[model samples]
Target: MNMKHVFNSNPLRYTAVLGLFAILLAISCTSEKEPLPDECEGSISLQTTIGSEANCGQSTGSFTVVATGGSAPYTYALNGGTAQSSASFDNLAAGSYTLTVTDNSGCTAEISVNIANQDGVNASISGTTASDCDTPNGSISVSATDGAGPYQYKLNDNAFQSGNTFDGLAPGNYTVTVRDANNCEVSLQATIKSDVVFAQVKNIIQTNCAVSGCHNGTTFPDLRVDNNIVAQASRIKARTGAKTMPPSSSGRSLSDDEIAEIACWVNDGASLN
Candidate 1:
């Protein structure tokens, strides 16, 4: 056959085979592109919330760092070089620091933190006052102003409940104290006296019947002006009749006038009036 005749006879088949080969070559080229570099391997990021920076005293703050785009299980370090494993730090000293994180992919990232010292806490007691003695319903309220919370209270150097009212306390002097969370305390003094009639009777009885080892509570018959007044008066009368009221020894005896006063007080219905 002539050359021209042979080429024309199979042109359609040769063209189809060439087209299929070109399509396969295109597919292979598309698959060869290197997988997009794995999203920048071993990336890390950090965050921080700092406490007050001036006069630190119980102030606290925290920071956190995370590794992304890297491998599992990243490591952390603080102050640019200090090594650590935990991703968080708390209540750190006041200062500046740099947080660095490294991922398993060997990628590292850093962040800066400004830590400031906090102002010292201060506390003061307000609205607190010493209470009078012998007051049936006396109270002193304590309040803290411009300071931290959690306050405490005391009375007469004894622990007392907060916002407590001391009632029916006998006539005498008292001290009230208040303390704050920081253990700072303030104190005040108050005096209370019995009412007119009771006060007069108390004074007279204390001067006469309440002599040491005599009619006192520690004596044979424990008698206190605030308690067992009538019983004590009867005892005194019996002792006076026997001329034994003004005990000679111990240098402790009531004068004749004082004795008369006590006896009159007892005879007058033992009335406070």
Candidate 2:
């Protein structure tokens, strides 16, 4: 008998052969499904290092972030900002922030951080008062502590200077500002005083001009009163400089030294101090 005729004639044997072919096809299909990559299999992890605090009114704070255990080539973002390849961020003010890291396989990890503020610049100012009204011989010095060092000093809207001491300052109120290397600053009020010239001017007036007949309370420009002397400063400077005051013919003329003293007082802003 022929083999093909024998197989077709056996119905149970034909069904069994068909079932074997179906089992082999299912195994082949299952083998085609690929396994996940080893790199992208694990969970992502994050680590961070908190940075130094910022100074007053400055954005000098910074922090760093590192990621691992997910995939290679990660990106970092701060507070949901644009992603960057670098793990570090800088020039930040004191505040709270959220840092996020992402891997090549889109796996993400995050953490929260806080940047603090440093103590502001601390300073103490001291100075010498002017010796004479005609001279700007006063000086001021500042000693500062805290914050960054190598400090700069400024006096009353002037340019900043590296030196701690400022000379040739006039007698008056002054604003002293001190700034550190980090640009943290503090301000203080100072005063330079001159009692010598003010007293001399008063004495000269009282002994000569402010007497009975000259500039006493009855005179046209009463030099006896402090207010009147201030008001007539310009005239006093002019007349004394020209040697025309105390009237040479009156036999009570002022000496050259006295005239110069009055002129210096008048030129020095005619202040009572």
Candidate 3:
């Protein structure tokens, strides 16, 4: 007579077991939901820094990119540059740039670069001038402002030579070029002049004056090309220009051109040919 009671007695128990199974299934599904971002891949971040310009003539600077929060073995690429294994890029000119870094997990990090080239190398001239008679062997000294030093010099398209100076240059027009370590270059014109030993005057002396008995030995100012020349160029011009030189026996009087040439020679810094 208790058959009905037996069936009804387990109804609540069966319902509770079914409810518990549903709760367990829900919890399992919630735990298995597509894993959080970090579980499979990490968020990517990039840090960058620029290196100062070191190589002079080079128009570019250097920069570095670092990546974090991704898989190992990263690859790097610049905006217009090729992909490289390392995060460092060299010889990049002064300007703004972007770097992209990719990790093994396909995650990407981007960074900005700001490099400075400062002013293109600036050069200054500070050496002595060259002239025809005096200081014929003069040299020029050059210096740089804003680039790697120990610069190189080029004269008239000649090969580059180390140092900031050009030496022993002859009197004339010159195109001087200065280059820095980075190969950056600047050009300028340089003129050399000398105030001594005018060839015309020398020829005049050797032809009309500088005679064996006149200015050879006992005479002052040695009016000859090879008559023991000295640093008396100004004195020679003073006397010659004044028409007090070349006594009667020394031949004809110097023409206006001849006198002007003497004055020019004395005023040109007296460089020797």
Candidate 4:
């Protein structure tokens, strides 16, 4: 029989052969995908300042790390030091330091921070003072010549208020002192006073009206006078002598001299001027 005739007669067998060729072609076209690049390394940065150029004992510094292309949660170190986040050191001797950062991917970067010895001592303490006057409420300020952070401050040698500011401080003399990160200190004195005469009223209230067993919070007739001297005087001195203050039995009435002073103060129109 002829070859053409034989092939046509066995069409089912030919179909099976074609199907196997298609399967082989599909397998050959299956290409593998490329892999991704490795993660980026972590990095570190450092900042520093010395307390004084003449003194090496007053240096302060801090360091931070930024991680990239690495796993979450990186670690930091300084001059072989170790920390989980940012790190700070105070009163360090002036010198050089190396900060290193390592990420979860085991990548690392480093930076250098230099601290120079100090040369001059700081003068003055930073601070301001105010009188109970109303003109100028008060002011908050600082005095510093040089050096970085790690600062400490005090008001009249008392604990310093944070945020580098104080408000509503009673009017009077005040001393403020500030020490920078390098332990260099600077101080300043300031005075704030109000023009209003009620400034004196504050003292009067504290001494007389607000005294215990008097017009204090718990006292009877509850004459809790504020900065209003006129109101206070009206309550203490009634036009009718029968209303004389500090009833005879009260045992703590204002002395004659004290009453006379209040009368004069009121007659003066309670002028703070």
Candidate that scores best on lDDT: 2
**What TM value does model 2 have?**
0.39
List per-prediction Cα lDDT, in the order shown.
0.51, 0.70, 0.62, 0.49
The stretch of ten residues in a row with the least summed lDDT in candidate 3 is 29-38
Q: How accurate is candidate 2 locally (lDDT)?
A: 0.70
- Show pairs that collide, candidate 2: none
Show how many residue pairs clash in every candidate, following the order shown. 8, 0, 25, 25
What is candidate 2's lDDT per residue for 212-247, written digit by digit as tens? 545665445667778767767777767767865554
Candidate 2 residue spans exceeding 4 A from truth: 1-55, 58-118, 195-198, 214-273
Candidates in order, TM-scores: namely 0.26, 0.39, 0.32, 0.27
Give stretches of model 3 more than 4 Å off.
1-118, 197-273
Candidate 3 C-alpha error for residue 137, in Å: 1.4
Candidate with top TM-score is 2
Cα lDDT tens digits for candidate 4, 37-123: 244553433334433332634444333334454455667676666565644444544444556767676666666554444542243
lDDT of 3 at 84: 81
Candidate 1 residue spans exceeding 4 A from truth:
1-42, 49-59, 120-273
> What's the C-alpha lDDT at position 161 in model 4?
50
